[model samples]
Structures are given as structure tokens and as C-alpha cells.
Target: MLRIGVLVSGGGTNLQAIIDAISNGKITNAEIVTVVGSRPGIYALERAKLNNIPSIVISRKAFNSLEEHDTAVCEHMKYCDVDLIVMAGYLSIVGDKLINEFNNKIINIHPSLIPSFCGPGFYGLKVHEAALERGVKITGATVHIVNEVCDGGPILLQKAVEVKPGDTPEVLQKRVMEEAEWEILPKAIDLIANGKI
Candidate 1:
């Protein structure tokens, strides 16, 4: 089975989605071997613990620089024998060291379609806020390989989520997650695990 190492920062709804996919056999060729959280108290840790998956806390404040922090994360992922690093709402910007080590092996599920409400400074509800402010009729999510460039990688999958009227950033964010991110992320993982990506 493929050993997946997930990195998270916040609520970890995306992590839950992947767990569910595995449980339901939507993805059967792999398992979440390890989970890493950037902060201490994030719900992602609880999700990993509940599933009996090994988890680690790599606090950003513990390191002197971003490279130091990513080096630590990279080392841990290596130690875990992670075949694929999945960034499930993981907010930390990975350093070139990790990117170079993983190459196209790392993937991220961004909240919005690439080249639109994505890239640097575009995360969480901020992407939805930009989509709402711009009055875009459609917004969605993207699962792509992680590279040095923010949200700049070969797109693996994408699905459109409609921008409904009177939608708050939070509401749109949830809709996109449920409608697009949740679905395609696991599908992408399955594809990668099956050597279909």
C-alpha cells in the first residue's frame, strides 16, 4: 500500500474527507501513514488520532527560518517513509528543499480554481472573498502537484462550484469544499496511487 503523509494547518475537513474515502474504499490502494500539523491545537491532530494514524506537531515558531521549518518537516516525512505528501489545508509554504526532495510527489488541494482566486495570499476564506467581490459566476477547487511556485503546478483535477446569490465567504468556502475539493482530492490521490496520474 502507498504510505501517505498528510500536512494540515486548520480544521482538517479535507483530511476527514480523505479518511472517509479510504474507509469507503473510494481509495483502497493506500493509507494515511502519518499526519503533520503546523500548529499544536489544530483539529487535524484529533482526526489523525481518532483514526489511529501517527501524528506529529511541527510548530512554525520552533524554527528560526522557513527553510529550517520545512527542513524539519521534510526530515519527518522522510522518516515516515511517505510516498506522497498531501497538503490538506496545510497553510505553511513548503521550502525548495521539500519541493526538490518530493518533486511532483507532493500535492495540494487549493480552495479555488488556479490562476483565479489562487496563488500567494489566497487561502481559506480569502479566495472565496475575492471570488465574491469579483462577482465571478463560477468558482471551484483544484488539486495539483506542489511546486516552488504558489498554486503553479500540473493540474490533476478541477470541478466548478456555482457562486450563489447572498453567499458569504464562509458559505462559499464550505460549498466549494463539499462540492469540489472533497470529491476531487481523493480521486486525485486514488489516481496517483494507481499510477494513473
Candidate 2:
């Protein structure tokens, strides 16, 4: 089985989707072995606990530097024997140590279609807000390999969601999550876990 370590910062809707997908057999040959929260008291950690998965909290603020924080994360993943690292709404910008250690084993689910409203400073609701502001008719999600660059990795999967009239950023964000992020993230995981990628 492919051992996965999920990294999260806030509400873990994407993480929940992965758990559900695995539970329902939509994703075979993989299991979530560990969950690491960037901060304590996040709902993602609670989800991991409820699911009986091992979890840890490693806050960047507590570390002396970004490299130190990423080193701690990498060590924890190595300890867990994780084959893959999934960034599910993880807000922290990982440094080179973790990226180099994990290499192509890391994947991230971006809320937007990427290359449009993604990159540094584009995350969470801000992405949706930017999309709406740009008045794009189509907005979606992208699952891609995590590299040294932010959201600049090779794309694995993308699903487009239509931008409807009278849609606010919040509404579009929910739609994109439901229609795109939730669907493609698990599919990407399955693809990677099965060695189809």
C-alpha cells in the first residue's frame, strides 16, 4: 500500500475527500498514515484523530527558520515511512529541505486553475476573489507535483468549473471545491498511488 502523509493548515475539506475516497474504495492501494498540521488546534488534526490516524503539529512560528521547520516536517514524514506527501490546504511555503527530500513525491491541490490566479500571494479565498475580479468565465482546480516553485510544478489533473452569473467569491470557491477540487485531488492520488502517473 502507498503510505500517504497529509499536510494541512485549516479546515481539511480536501483531506476529508481523500479519507472518504479511500474508505469507499474509489482509491485503492493507498492509506493515509499520518497527518501534520502546520499549527495546533486546527480541524484537520481533529479529523486525523477521529479517523485514528497518527498526527503531529509543527508550527513554523515555533521553529528558528523555514529550513528548520521543513526539516522537522521531513523527518516526521520519514519516520512515518510516507511514500507521498499531499498538501491539502496547507498554507505554509515549504523550504528547499522538505522539497528536496520529498522531491516529486509531493503533490498539492490548488483551488484555482493555476497559472491564472495562482503563485505566491494567491491562496484560499483570495484566489477566488481574484478570479471573480478578473471576470473569468471559467475557474477550476489543479492537482500538481510540488516543486521548489509555488504552484509551478508539473500538472497532474485539472477539472474546470464554470463561473456563473451573480456568483461571489465565496460561492465560486464552494462550487470549485465541490465540483473540481474534491474530485480531481483524489483522482490524482489514485493515479499516483497506482503508478499510472
What residue pairs clash in candidate 1, if any at all?
Answer: none
RMSD of 1: 0.6
Compared with the true structure, model 2 gives a TM-score of: 0.99
Q: Quote model 1's TM-score.
A: 0.99
In model 1, the worst 10-residue window by lDDT is 111-120
**Model 1 misplaced stretches (Cα beyond 4 Å):** none
lDDT tens digits, residue span 1-197, model 2: 99999999998999999999999989999999999999999999999988999899999999999888989999999999999999999999888988998889999999888788989999999999999999999999999999988899999999999999999999999999999999999999999889999
Clashes of 1: 0
lDDT of 2: 0.94
